[model samples]
Target: MASTMSRLMLGRTLERICKAVLLLCLVHFLIMMILYFDVYSQRFDIFSRFNNGRGANASRGPHHYYYNYSRPNTTFPSYLPGADQLLPTAKPEANRTRPTPKPIPPCPEVPPGLVGRLLIEFSSQMTMERVQRENPNVTEGGKYTPTDCRPKQKVAIIIPFRHRDHHLKYWLHYLHPILRRQKIDYGIYIINQLGEDTFNRAKLLNVGYTEALKDAEYDCFIFSDVDLIPMDDRNLYHCYDQPRHFAIAMDKFGFRLPYAGYFGGVSGLSKKQFLKINGFPNEYWGWGGEDDDIYNRITLNGMKVSRPDVRIGRYRMIKHERDKHNEPNPQRFNKIQNTKNTMRKDGISSLTYRLASVKKYPLYTNISVEIGKPPPRPIKG
Candidate 1:
C-alpha cells in the first residue's frame, strides 16, 4: 500500500511541471505574434505615407517627382528580411516635352544714343584704312547690329558704285557713326559695274537687292548715291509704309529739290514695296532717267515718296566730276515717257548679269558684275 501512494504522487508532480512549461510557451508565443503584427503595421503605415506623398506630387508634373532611386550606385543588404520588396517600383517618365523659349522683343524706335543734327565734315586725308580703324564695330561685309537691343529693322544700304573711292571714304566715315546712333541693324553693299560700259545704276541697284537677300533676309533696302551723306542722325535708315526719300534737300541742288518729281539721291524701299513696283526699270542705262523712271513706277503702283522735314532730311554731296562712261543717255526722255509700258517686263523679272567677283572688306561688301552693254540700237531699215 505504501509503495502505490508514492508512485501516484510522483506522477502528479511530473504532470504539474509539464503543464507549467506548456503555459509559459503559450504566453511567449502570444507576445511574439503581437510584436510581429505591430512591426508590420508600422511598416505598412510608412509605405502608405510614401505612396500618398508620391501621388500628391504627381499633379505637379514629372519634373517635381522624377528621381533615379534604382541607380547603379544604390545598394541593398541581402541579410535584411524582404529588402528587395520594401518599396514599389518607379515608372519611366512618359511623353516629356521641353518648354519653348520666349521670343525676343523688337528694339525701341529711337535709340538712346541718338544725338540729332550731327556735325558734318570732309577732309582730303581721309583714307579707307582710317575709316575702317574708326569703325571697328562694323564687321566684315559691313554688318552691324546694336549689342544692347534687337534692331527695329534690318537695312541693306546699296550704293551703285564705280570709280569713286574718294567719295566712298567720306561716306563710310560719316555714315557708320550715324547708322550706329540710329540703332540700325545694317550692311553696306557696293554694287560696282565691272567694265567701262555705260553705268547701269538701276540694274546695279536691282543686283544689290538680289545679292543682299542671299546673305541675309534684309527687309529694308536703302538705294543711295555714294557721294551723298546725311547731315542728321535722326534721318533714320529704316523702311516705312511708303517709299522713303532720305536725301530730300541735298546741298548739290542748293539744299532744295530741283523739281517736284525729283527722286534722286538716297531712297529707302521695303522688300514688298520694291516687288510691288517690279523694281526699278532695267532699261535706264544712264544717270538722268533711272531716278525719274523709278518715281513713275512708284506712282503707277499707287505708292508715294515719304520724307522727313527739311531740317532732318539735310544732306551734303561730295563734289566730284561726272564719270567718263556715265554720260547722259540721249534716249532718257523717250524711256521716261514709256515707263508704264516697260516697267513690268523690264524690271527685276527681266534682269540678268554675270558676277565678276564678290569681296567682303572691313567697311563694306563689294559686288562687281558685268551687266551687258546696252541693247544695240535697232538696225534702221
Candidate 2:
C-alpha cells in the first residue's frame, strides 16, 4: 500500500514542471510577432509619405523604392545608408518659358526685280501722265525707295535742262524702271535754266547740288543729261570710291568712246569726291568745254574714273537739233587751257544764281533758276 502512494506523487510533480515550460514558450512567440509587425509598419509609412500617399503599394519592392527616390523634388532620408548611390540625380525644373527670337532683315546687294538686259522703246504717245501712272511708288518730289528691302545708297539725279520736253518724257519712261531694278533710293531734280542767255550747263549742275542737299542728305550725286538713257539696267547709277562715268559707250558714237578724256553724258560723284574737285567749272557757258574741264578737275584731284564693262555701260541718245542760243563759246579752248589756275576760283564757291521757282512735278523736281550772261569779250587790237 505504501509503494502505490509514492508513485502517484512522482507523476503529479512531473506534470507541473511540463506545464511551466509550455507557458514560457507561448510568451516568447507572442513577443517575436509584435516586434516583426512594428518594423514592417514603419517601413510602409515611410514609403507612403515619399509617394505623397498615392497608393499603399506605390513602392512595394526595392526597385520601386529606387525609382520613386530618383524623381524630381523627392526628399531622401539621411538615416538610410548609401541611398544616393541607388538612384540617378534629378535635374531642376525651369520656372519660366524661353523667349522667341526676332527675324533678320533682308540684304540689298542683289535686287529681285533686276532684268539684266532691257528693250528700250520710245513712242510719241508716251506722256508724262502715263509715266506717272506707271510709277505710282514715286513720291511727290520724285523720291523712290524699293519696297522689298532697304537701299544700299541714297542717290540724287541732277539733270540740267533748258527745253526738251519730249526727251524728258522718254527719260522718265525708261529710267524710273531701271533705277527701281538697281535698288537705289533716289530723287530726280531737273535743274532748269531760266531765260535764253547762253545756256550755262555747268553752273546749273552746281545749283542742283546745292538745292538737293536742302531736300535730303544725299550721299551720291549723278549729273545726267536729259536726253541720254541707259540701254542696260546693269549700268548702275550708284557712286563708287572714285568718279563713275556711266555713258562710256553711247549709240551716238557708234557704241564706242569718242575720246580717251570724254567724261560727259552721265557721271556719278560721291560727296567727298565732288568736294575735293571744287565741283564743275561755272565759266563753261556752252556744252563742249564744260565736260573736258570737269575731267581735268577729276585728274587734278588724284581720283581716276571708274567705268563698267563696255557691254554693260551702253546708252542711247535722243535725236534732236542743237538749241537756238546755245552756240559754241568762241573762247572754250582758251578757257580749258587755264582750268588748273581758274578751277579754285570759278567753281561752286564762286557760283551765283537767282532761284526762279521750285516745282515738284509727278515725275521730277523742276528747279528753275536765272543765271546771268557771260562777261563781254575784249576786242583784239
Candidate 3:
C-alpha cells in the first residue's frame, strides 16, 4: 500500500512539471510573436538596431535604384501600341501670335504756336514773389492750380523704433515703394530717442501721434516697427473705419498667431480714432505689454480691432543684433495692469516732444523729432 501510494504521488508530480514547462514555452513564443508582428512593434522607431552584416548588402541592389533615375522613354507604353504613330507631325514653320505693343499716350496736345508762350507765362507766374497769385483755373486767392496740384492727403508713417539699423533699412527699402505706389502723400517719421534709457516703445508711438499732427494735418497714422517687412503689396498702411493690425501672421511665430489678442509689429489707426483712445500707454517700455495695452484701449473705447487674413498678412523679419536699452522690460505686466488710469494722464494730450529738424527733398519729406527722454522706471512706486 505504501509503494502504490508513492507511485501515484510521483505520477502526479511529473504531470504538474510537464504542464508548467509547456506554459513557459508558450509564453516565450507569444513574446517572440509580439516583438516580430505586433501592430505597435512595427511602429517602434526608438532603439531600433540596423543589421550591420555583409549579407544585408544583397538586399540593396545597385541596378534596382539606378534604373529608376534614368530618363523616361519618349514613346508610349507597349499597351498603347499605335498612340505615338497616330499623332500629327509638326510643320517646319508655323504662324505664331505676336502681341502688339501698347501705344504710349501722347502728352496733352496744345497748339504748337502757344506752347512756347505758355511756357514763358508759366515760368513768370511761378515766381516766389507771386506765389500767392492765382491763374484763371486757380481759386481767386489760392496760388496752386486746382488741377495742377492734387491735394495731398496727409499720411504719417509713425515708426516706434530703437537701435535697429539693418532692419530699419529693409523696412525703408520695401515700404517706400509701397507708400509711393499708394499715392496718399505720406511722410516717414521715425521717432528715435536721443539716448539709451529704458526703451519706451509706446511712448515713442504716442510721441509720433502728438508731434506728427503738430506740423501738418495727418488724417492717418501708421504705428509700425523697424523689423517687420510686409510680404504682400496689398497690406495698405492706411487704416479703414476700425483699427487695423497689419502684421497678423509673421514667420517668427510660424506664420500663425501664437494666441488671440496678439497685436504686435505693424498696426495703423486714424488720428481721430487714436486721440479718442488717448493713444497708447507710455509705461510699456521694453518689448512686451504695449501691444496688449493698445488692444485694451481699442476694446474699452467701444472699437473693434480688425486684422488681415493669414495669407495676406504675412511679414518677414530681418535677423540682426539686439538693441541697447531695448531689452525685454520685466515690469511690463505691472504697468499693463494700471494702463487704463495712466494712459488718460500721460498720453497724447499731456505728451511733449521737440522737433529736431525737417528736410524736404524732391520726392518726399523727412521730419526728425526729439522725444527727449523716456519716463521713470515703471517698477518704482
- lDDT, candidate 1, 181-242, per-residue tens: 88899999999999889888999999999999999989999999999989889898999989
TM-score of each: 0.72, 0.73, 0.56
Model 1 lDDT vs. the true structure?
A: 0.86
| Model 2 C-alpha lDDT per residue in residues 93-125, reported as the tens digit of each score | 464456885543553565666787777766557
RMSD of 2: 11.5
Q: Model 1 clash pairs?
A: none
Q: For model 2, state the Cα shift of residue 275 in Å.
A: 0.5
Query: What's the candidate order when arranged by decreasing lDDT?
Result: 1, 2, 3
Error of 2 at 158 (Å): 0.3
- Shift of residue 33 alpha carbon in model 1, Å: 44
Quick one: ranking by TM-score, best first? 2, 1, 3
Each model's lDDT comes to 0.86, 0.85, 0.63
TM-score attained by model 3: 0.56
Task: Give the TM-score (vs. native) of candidate 2.
Answer: 0.73
Q: Give the poorly placed runs of model 3, Cα more than 4 Å off.
A: 1-153, 359-381
